[model samples]
Target: MNDQTKGIIAWIIIGLIAGLVASLIVGGAGSIIGWLIAGLIGSVVGGFLAQRFDIKLNLGNPFFEQVIVSIVGAIIVLIIAQIIT
Candidate 1:
């Protein structure tokens, strides 16, 4: 696959993992579509937070790094959703 395809696939995987973990932690629930939405949004949020706060992971694996960041971001998203609802 091309670089774009790879990146998209990576993001999906990261989103699934992050969404599930965040939902579990925050006592939120969702379907596959919900998880995907949360995960994608989480990825963006995580990236922004990392850039703003200089968050870094020395996991030596980009996938793991993304997962960790995504999870944190997803948690924040869940909290906001809770507050808003």
Candidate 2:
């Protein structure tokens, strides 16, 4: 697949996983769909936040950086969702 496609898949996976993790940490019901949504939203928010913080996301082989971004993004999403819910 292309880079964009790969990125989408990556985000979905990350979102799903992050959601589950966040929900567990927050002691809430586990919803894959919800997690996926949060993950997707988190991806966007995280990307923007990272950029604003001068933290660069690698489009290449830097896997760790991406993971960090995903986790941070997931955390942000969880926080927002907590407030909204």
Candidate 3:
């Protein structure tokens, strides 16, 4: 797949994983679809945070960057979810 396709898939996977993890940590009030949305948003937040912190995996592609970004994004989402609920 092309970089964009890979990136999209990567974000979806990351979103699902991150959402699941968040649900596990926080408990309930979440679904796969919700997590998916959270994950996508998280990636954007993660990217912003990563850029601010100068953190990068340097895998030489947006995919790696997105992966890193998603992890951060997941964490942010988790925290927000925890706080909101």
Candidate 4:
């Protein structure tokens, strides 16, 4: 696989983890597609919020850090969704 392919796979893995964890924390219908969507969008929002807020998680492993950040972001997304719908 190429570098881009590897990166996409990594993101999917991280997103799955984050989405599952976030859903459990926030209460959501657990589904593969739901998790993927939440995780992907959460990753972007979380990365942006973290940068804007100067929040850096020193989780040692970069992948773990990404998952945690994504989870947090997903939680926020889920909460906003609940409010909207």
Estimate TM-scores for all models.
0.93, 0.71, 0.65, 0.95
Instruction: Go through the candidates in order and give the clash count of each.
Output: 0, 0, 1, 0
Show model 2 residue runs off by greater than 4 Å.
27-29, 56-61
1 versus 2: better lDDT goes to: 1
lDDT of each residue in 1-85, candidate 1, tens digit only: 8999998898898998888888888867478777877878888899899989997898999889989999989889988988999
Residues 16-82 of candidate 4: C-alpha lDDT, one tens digit per residue: 8888888999978389889888888899999999999999899799898888889999999888887
Per-prediction RMSD in angstroms? 1.0, 3.0, 3.2, 0.9
Off by over 4 Å in 4: none
Residue 32 in candidate 2, Cα distance off native in Å: 0.9
**Candidate 2: which pairs clash?**
none
- Model 4, residue 22: what's the lDDT? 86
What is the alpha-carbon RMSD of candidate 1 to the true structure? 1.0
Tell me how candidate 2 scores on lDDT.
Answer: 0.70
Tens-digit lDDT track of model 3 for 1-85: 8999986786688777666665565564387887787777777788788889988687888665675577567767778877887
RMSD of 2: 3.0
Q: Of the pair 1 and 4, which is ahead by lDDT?
A: 4
Error of 2 at 52 (Å): 0.2
Pairs clashing in candidate 4?
none
- Residue 36 in model 1: shift from native, Å? 0.9
